[model samples]
Target: MRPRYMLSGNISPPSSAMALYSTPRSDKRTLQRNRRWPGSSATRSSATSTLSRSGSMLSSCLQCRTSTCRRISISERVICLILHSRFSFSKYMSESHLSLRVCYRKIAVDEGGLPSWANSKYRKYTPGKPHPNAIEYLVAVDENFFAFNITWPQDDSKKYDDPEKKLDQMRAYVTYFVEYDKQQLPRSKQPYIFYIDSRWASLKLMELLHENQLFGVLSCGENMRPKVLWSWIKADLAKYDWWSIGLPRLSANLVCVRTKDKVYLKILTNYCALKEIQYKKRKRKFPMTEFYVAACDVQKEYNAFKCKVDQLNKAVLEYFRLSRYLDDKVTFTQFFIHLFTVQSWTYYNACTGRSLSQLEYRVLVLQELAVEILPPPQPSVLAVHWPKHMGGRTHNCQYSPCRNNCTYFCIACEKWGCLKCLEKAHLNG
Candidate 1:
């Protein structure tokens, strides 16, 4: 026979802590229900006698005494006692029925990985994609200048002390470049394109563009120059004259080889607005804003926004006056040269409204002309110059063109290199 396995414990009512205290009669009812009922007096007495014997056996088992042991095989009685104990123990469980229900509901809802139902309520809705034809092509360019600063030592005794201006100047140059790029590029492109160096600031600008949904192509180092990217854009826009002019113009001056070229400047203006507004008191009592310049290269120039009969005649006369300077029938190069020269003069006059000395005016004109003719100097040519014989044997010469050196050099030139020394040297020669 197989060895019998049974749970060993005294079958007793649950403790006061576990029992249902609110219902005082529950324990009595449980006991009554578990007991056998409606028996003859002799049978009852026999049952009582059996209960007494079983109770004594249970007490002996608790004390680990085996002298008087008894076995009872009533499975129903055991099951009923377990049920009563469970009901009594449940009273001590802390969670209320309502709280348990809520907990189960939460578990059921979160069984899946994500709350897809909540997504509909919390997530933003996006519209359908735009029609291909409705989208417009846009291009933007940003440019900036880089320069260095220099500072001079204040004390004569501290020969080794260097100035702090050079670093400050470089900082300013970079700051200006960043500001110009931000102000110009966004306005120029539809969504906007950003052009910048491979420096940290440039990377930051690109990030800003990306966040704005502005499309742009980044070029590192020398590739970041505006001329290279803008040339292709201008060529593309050449076919659409009106649309080209309507495009925004970047405020940052592009560093282009052809930027100063007469031909390129003309081409650029063809798609850009180059206007010289001259204000004059008019007789008509019109809004001051209405008196502003209304002009375009292709269309007839007029005083008013609309084309009126008398206004058209005046516009025709003005157009003829302006066109006389332009090469209407010349080759592309000659035409561009003429346009570039005339526009340059006009822009100069507008910018410097006051009368200037002949020398000053000539210098300004030459500078403008040179911009078209001269290419940027090579790095070697533009490199900082240091005097080889500055200090006695060229040893410890401070050959690194310090702030004091540059200022001293400029002053020496302006003062004509020490008049007394120059005269003595001349006499010796």
Candidate 2:
């Protein structure tokens, strides 16, 4: 018999009080945030029940359960999601000109089972099938945002006995990663970070990173382990973007690196925006009038509401534990489910014509407790309009390099100098 698993829509919360309320909740904006609905809070539970239906959808798709893997069936929502994802992944595969077989993880015959595999000597190391490296790929998930880290070791011998196979594997992995980022992850919210240790840094990989618009330190030698607080700043921020200009490694001292990076400064600048965002959040605030009308005892109603939330959250957490992220299909489908579900709940709340209760608001706030959004980049003046001492400064002599400012500038040096200086600056001045 297949057990059923249902997934309904929900919303995300603010970043201030994540620890207090870990359940999914949100406001009017984020999940297509301002969407409208025809129902009220009374129907919210029904919506969740309808989505889960028999809980079969996820069971069929992923064999895991909330606490343990069990026999289960797939939900219509999850099935449809899987189908949609296949189409998208197919399109991506076609565009990248890479075969699908290569992109997915390689599965093997393990008939002997876990105990046998565990006892084998070959299994102790990289073995026939390679084990994943911690530094190479790491995922740090919070309520609103996720941070991923990818690195290559100083020595590349463990991956594959054949060097060519390793490179192919890397390319395939990177292809999926890039696409997964575009399709699933929300880059508009904040830039994704990538840390490429110089050890196995490839030209093609670096090019891919730059296409995403980030910084890089042109290091030719070994990796630098961070020692100081400032350098740690670079280390921390570098793991969250597609390409990070990683800290220049110079000995064990953090300050020894040359040319400080603006990423840290930019990150610091975002703190102010983060605070503003926090200030703007509406939390733990419910519609008192609606609550008063709905129940004779507001306190009792509040307690029941809190209990309901807790129970639902537990179910969600349990179901979520079953799946693994080996492909974009699962990640994206799950994300889509999570995304729209959140919006639906928020919209439903609005329809309920009730103000959010303190407990509800707190749950919403918890969703974003760890998430921090980076402020949009400020607009910059064109190079043509910049002052000579700004980006316009040139190492060339006072001679202007261009003739548009010929009256008072030196065309040879792009300097704002008298025409006379053009002739004498290089030779005499």
Candidate 3:
């Protein structure tokens, strides 16, 4: 008897596979063109077409290495499996702005299936060096680490001096967030705040955020703002350790804090006032482990919520690094698989309060998928009875009185057994 694992299903392909493997329109055209004449020997092209049609199912089945997914296209097979298994995990969303911590992070993917046209148009070049071929994705996540708004792969190359062109990619990011926010949290009364770093700060973006009735707490850089104002702020830092200036036209205020060694942190926001609030930080000198408290509401809010997106990025990288599996042929499949894993992990942790680590959760998911979708290995030699590795799976030894788990399957006996069990069952008998 076959050993049951975490999940059980009939050892057959689902009905949905039939729809996926149905003859495509282009294949039908080839059939009409390659029809053999009744009275003449079949042409080479006709024979070729016949062979291809006959081999399609066999090839697809081999590619998946599974009888249950026989004849299903690889892309469709993966997507179908994902969709089918999605019923077990629930989707989660923030209820309102009070609980929502909106932040943005750019996910840089190296050597994926990004289109060449967009790549060339937005490729970045340093003063004396060429940047790598990579696709940059703008991802926005809530406090729960759920990535609600994700952009398609785009080039991150931008001109630092031109704020308009600099935030061209941000347009899509903001649009997606706004649309999703309206649909998911329609009853929430407070405006949504988008937390972004200095690279994304600009007056034009501020206007767009205000237009959408959203707010932002963006870290500002000298190069990202007008030179005159930036210089004024830098010089004025000599007289005062910290100060804020309000821009009446943009309905935003620029706040700068002069830290130890004259290093300054600047923030631009329409939501946060120029009032001070208590916050703690590590000392900036040697033995920096000591904590100190300061009063600044803008810095406090920015520091408290700025790392949500970074945390999400860290989780995606540290837990399941998908870069090694990313290839041009299966880029789409692998990318979505990673995305789904992240979403599932976040939602599971939020809803269940489970103490499972990210790595453990991923392993559990893989085990569940293997039981449901993966097939047993084919026998190399039917005439010979020998044990074969079960592809990292373990089953109870089928030999009577043997209670040990085994990773090897005996072909002739059609049973899972350890080496000792196999030797005793076959050699002794």
Candidate 4:
């Protein structure tokens, strides 16, 4: 039988909390009716009766109990709830053309204070990074603002030979999604568009995407191949201000745009067309520029949907954060725990069509988990026994089942009994 959690206390936020989300009348009513906590009297009684048999309670030893509680399994329960519902994962994937954003998150640590057992190749402290003394992870997030793929943690302390194994890591990350689509999202026919930054973008990676029938919008640097286009764009930067200078290619379109700040933004996209390039002009004061900032269709599209992985990082960090002192395994475990919570939160929004603040959702999840993992308190048993000493007195046993004369008295019940009756009255009781 499937286990059900019946929490026996009020754990929901006040009704006014719903006002913050401005939830619809129907959703509000549903939440009030369905939110589980101190449910009906029958449920509470049933849960109490099943607590010991269900084996949900923690062990007596602290270390053994901690080891038994697996957060990953708990997260899987959240996924199970979503899967059993009418909401179809494959359908959702097919309906939306998701933008897959690839990025990195630094798991900072203190090098000097690290424990002796923390001897990992990837846990070295680089001198000049934002998280110089930290471990790094290659993370991928979709348009839903939830991370679905994560690479093994990289060792940053080694010699800076390659840029995070540029082409190799990209292929690995893309391969995961491709396989996932084939298995879990069989109906998802459309290919995903990956948003890659200039540092990680390469010709080989672009070719890989093409071979897989996927699309990508990659940022190009000034030194990127095809020196002719970069040279022309740099020479005539002002002329292309507020204009999308398109150099169409067989597999990609090289787009260059100049903003009022005098910075040239180079973009390479396989999905965009020369005719689809939308340009707009906005006048500026201060410097008295003719057209301040040019908004190109390619740039606008990239800016709007990209950086979702970064956004995921922001969302996770806003509430709780993992301790830096943990080892690599424990740290990654904590990171995924946070990601699972965010995933559940995103799923809730999609299912309900209402936006509940992250904080509130986290509170609700905590309360629900409390019900699943916390066991009901047990009633204290009365310990019935006699005093250690016996005075020179004889009396009949006061126990209902015994009829004897002796000098044994039970201090617990303040009763008398004989030697044989005392054993049955107190010791065996």
Task: Return the top candidate by TM-score.
Answer: 3
The better-scoring model by TM-score among 1 and 3 is 3
lDDT of 1 at 88: 31
Ranking by lDDT: 3, 4, 2, 1
Evaluate all candidate structures by whole-model CA lDDT and list the values in order: 0.23, 0.26, 0.51, 0.48
Residue lDDT tens for model 1, 1-429: 110111123222224312211111222221121112112121111111221211111110011101111121122112222243332323333332111110000000000011111212211221221221111111111111100111111112221112121122222222322333344422322232222212211223333333333332222232222324434323422211211111112111111112211322211111112222233333345454334332222121111211222222222123222222333233223422322333223223332344554345446556644664695765654233322223322122122232122211112222222233334434554
TM-score of each: 0.14, 0.21, 0.56, 0.54
Candidate 4 achieves a global lDDT of 0.48
| Model 1 residue 10 distance off true place after TM-score fit, in angstroms | 99
lDDT of 4 by residue, 19-60 (tens): 221212222222121112111222111111221221122111
Query: Whose lDDT is higher: candidate 3's or candidate 4's?
Result: 3
In candidate 2, how many Å is residue 211 off?
A: 4.3
Candidate 3: residue 293 lDDT (0-100)? 54
Q: Which parts of model 4 have CA positions greater than 4 angstroms off?
A: 1-120, 124-130, 153-165, 184-186, 227-229, 239-249, 274-293, 322-324, 375-429
Instruction: Please give, for residues 105-188, the per-residue lDDT of candidate 2 as tens digits.
Output: 111101010111222222223232223211121121111121111122223355323232233333332343444435532222
What stretches of model 2 exceed 4 Å from their correct place?
1-124, 127-156, 159-174, 177-191, 196-208, 211-429
Show the lowest summed lDDT stretch of 10 residues, model 2.
268-277
Candidate number with greatest lDDT: 3
Residue 94 of model 2: what lDDT? 29
lDDT of 2 at 382: 42
